[model samples]
Target chain A: MKISEKLARETLLEMQRRMLRIRLFDERASKMVKRGYIPGTVHTSIGQEAQVVGACMALKSGDHMTGNHRSHGHPIGMGSPLGPLMAELVGKATGVCKGKGGSLHLADYAVGSLGESGITGSSIPIAVGAGLSAQVLGEDRVALTFFGDGTANQGVLYESMNLASAYKLPVIFLCENNFYALSTPSHTVTGGRIVDRAAGFGMPGVRVDDGQDVMAVYDAVAEAVDRARRGEGPSLVEVMTYRFREHSEGLRINVDYRNSEEKQFWTARDPIVLFREALIAAGIATAAEMDAIEAEIAQEVEDCASFALESPDPEPSVAFEHLFTDAYDLEDVL
Target chain B: MSVMTYIGAIGAAQQEAMSADPRVIIIGEDVEANVYGTTGGGKQRAEQGDFVQQFGKNRIRNTPISEEAIVGTAIGAAMTGLRPIVDLSYSSFLYMAMDQFVNQAAKNRYMFGGQSSIPVVFRSAMFYGLNTGAHHSDRPYPMFMNVPGLKIMAPASAYDAKGLLRSAIDSDDPVLTFEAVPLWGAKEEVPDEEYRIPFGVARTRREGCDVTVVGVSGSLPLALQAAEDMAARGVSCEVIDPRTLVPLDTGTIVRSVLKTGRLVIAEPAHRTCGAAAEIAAVVADKAQHALVAPIKRVCALNMQVPFSPALEAQIYPTRERIVAAIEAVCADQLNAENRRVG
Candidate 1:
């Protein structure tokens, strides 16, 4: 189904807004890491913004999501506030996890971005659990989890799929096949097609070739989300995308794992530029409106960085706090 | 008070918890059929008794033989809202889901700045008395004790089993309860009324002054027997059981050591870096001045649990080993006093 048939012009523009926001936010985050403004390395989703934005756009506010290490774009796309998210990246007290969970562990439960996992294929079962929670509680909220091509080989992912299928859970397993699991080419490592593996587990698996097109990702994920919400069980949507930057910040720049030709091909299909052109070509938005959106997003990203910088560092004494719930009553037990 | 076996207490705990809180659910391999009989062994076991018929398959769910997925699902479900009580048939299979139990379930709360709580119970039957070979016979609670943000409970008696399981279900953090396979059929007087044994509280099974004996999990019964035998021989051994290992009752143990002036730790796990080692370190670090003799640890040898019943019996801590350790500690104290007087 075409996205234009279901969504209005404003919704299409908003999708572009989220994509641009992720792009600019990632760019600034990369610069901050380079300048030593951010303490730890940040995994920027620069080239893969459309997949995150598109998938998040298809879900309701109460729908749950779990992300991986390279997932700053996910919570941002799920409508998390820029200030706290940025604050968390900079280890500020005002951050979403109070600065305890920096870049890799960012979580905003209010927006149903359950949390991001540092372990590959770890969040898949977590997403299944969220789906189970919705099912057991008699809610229509579906759960979505984003993993990488590298995580396809993880045994736990298969186990999660089997459980989700057996229980008919409302979950969307979105695999972002960026051709590499870190430096290892996915083809050399992964045995069979990931989509086919989903079919083995009794779920529909679809491959979306246009990772650069936001509407394509939105439509594919929207279908999966609808099936899950309808209690039709889980579906796997593989969005083929690429990472323009190194695997992470501070990696060897001259690595030859990915050839120049491959890099150039994906670079030419930058999701933001492609989606912007699609919007203009479809006569849904003017060039001036596109320019205005970019300017607003740039300002929004700048404000996020400023707020993150101005936020206070967590108190040194509070480091031991939150290890367990206050109701634990360790003192009384002793 | 109602009489219940160790396994019966476990089933009662599951039934009461699920009845009291609808959010509590069970997921594991063979939970529907009770193949391993972990819920209870026999015709009227908990899994056999109308749980699937009443709670439906959604709540009392069964899964494929995937340890990682079972634990991962429980962790995820716990984080969202449900209190999942997942079983991993035997303690040896826990190695398959170490990443989920250690890295994910244990560290999620601390890593996420306490924004999420993994209120999941990973229940496993532990020990080596069944001659199930090395793979099936394991008491690996010490490995979990090293992980922060995880509460480890090893209940020895039927009464403590029910009470502690209930407490674990009510706890907001992730808890791993290791039930001794040998103690499953051991019966005791458990009250019908609801009760919960708080974590980190050491229970004094017997009081004495000559030597302090501390046992963990299945080793507690051996220590109690040794204490009785030593009492008949006029040794006056004091027995203490530190129910939960993470928030260990160091104060209670240290006080016991100060009063007795000697300590002996009995455990079923490997001697090196086992629960006994941790308890020994705590007593040595805190109550060293009060100790008149060197601390003794009666634990299994640092090797795999053998399949042969004789070999397994030789390896694990026994009542004779506990008695010998107590006698040696008492003898050393006397020698030290005599040497100082001379």
Candidate 2:
């Protein structure tokens, strides 16, 4: 089923809006990281916008999600404001997590994002846990976790799938197979199709071959999310997508891993541009309205960057804070 | 008061906590079957039968031998709601889930800037003296003590087992309870009324004037026996057990050392950077001027725990070694006094 048939025109436009938010925000973040605004490195969801926004938009606001190192997009897709996320990337006091998590770890509990992890395949089971909580508490909320194809081969994924299926948990194991894990091509390391592994665990596995199509990715994830909310079980949705930029901004991996032709092919199918054109072609939005959305997001991205840069650094005392619920001095405890 | 084994007290605590809060649930390998003798093999389980039958399948959930998922799921659940008691069975197998345990459970609250508290309990038994072999036999509490966000509990008696377990369940932060395998069968008097032992409080087992000896986890018995032996040998030795390692009661140990003027730390874990080392360091830092003699430590040798019982026994600290260390520390003060007189 097409999302356009069921979803409101505004919601469809919002999907494009969020996708654009991810694109422009990440694009701005990329430039900022290179310019020494963001500390460490930032993994931007530049090319894989549709896969991120589509899966995230499928769930209700109360539904939970966990992400990997490519962190900022999941929360943005879940409708988190751009300011705190950008502020967090800059290590500011007003940042989400109060600058403790930084860029690699971003958690906005206000929007039900449990948190993202730097370690691949680590946060996968955490989403399963959110599903477990919902079931035990008799809540209708479902949980979805995002991981890369590189993390697909991790044993924890199989362990998590087996547990979720055994308990009939309300969870969606969304594999963002962006074709590579850093410089290593996933095909070189991954033996079988990632979606096929779901069959072994007695769950339906759906692969969205055209992950660049936001609606296609949405239809698959929305169905999975529906099944999860109805208490059927967990489902594995592998979205075949690509990363337009390098693995991480400011990372100098000298290896010429991705060829120019392959890069151009993915660059042409940019999820944001594709969704914008689709919206205009369907008469859901006029070119001027689409232009206004892009302009609005561009302004939002600028405001976020300015807010992050102008924000104050966290107090030095915050380093010892939040270590435990009780504010015992670290010196005394040690 | 009633007589109960250490492991039995743990079971009582679990049943009590579950009864008190519906949010409390159990998840791990063989928790329903009570294979490791943690959940069932006691007076409580004998009366209640299978936990699955008592709490139903939803509350008493079992999982495949997936330690990583088991730990990670508990962290996620804890963050949202529901206090999970994850039975990892053996402390040695904790390595399989270290990423979730150390990276997620321990750091989640702090990493997220106090946005959420991970109120999960990871229960694992130390199997060092059970001849479980090198792979299984390990007192890994010292390693977890080094981690910041985690609260570590080592209950030496049936009373403490019940009380501390209750505290761990009630705590908002993530706590790891390391149950000593050797102490599981040992019986002690536990109060009939419910009680909770606060973390960072050191329990003074015996009072003395000559030296302060700190015993960690399973090694508490050795220190107590050594203290008794020292009493017979005309040496007064005070023994302290820091129940929770992370929120260590440095105040108690420092005060004890100030009164005694000497300190000796004993632990079942390896000698280097073991619990003993941390306790000794705390005493040295806090009460260095009061110390009349150097602090000595009695710990297992830094090596892979051998499969042979005899070889393993040789590596771990013994009552005799504890006594010897006390004697040497006491005599060292005398030598210092004699040298000053000359």
Best by TM-score: 2
lDDT of 1 by residue, B218-275 (tens): 9999999999997766678889999888678888999999999999999999999999
lDDT of each: 0.88, 0.89
In candidate 1, the residue pairs with backbone N, CA or C atoms under 3 Å apart (3 or more residues apart, or in different chains) clash, namely none
Q: Which lDDT tens digits does candidate 2 get at residues A150-208?
A: 99999999999999999999999999998998899999998989999999999999999
Error of 1 at A108 (Å): 1.0
Q: After superposition, how far is residue B40 of candidate 1 from its true place, in Å?
A: 6.1
Indicate the residue-level lDDT of B156 in model 1.
89
Q: What is the DockQ of candidate 2?
A: 0.84
**What is candidate 1's lDDT per residue for A206-312, written digit by digit as tens?**
99997877889999999999999889999999999999999898777556999999999999999999888888887888999999999999999999999999989
Question: With candidate 2 superimposed using the best TM-score fit, by how many Å does residue A21's alpha carbon deviate from the native?
Answer: 0.8
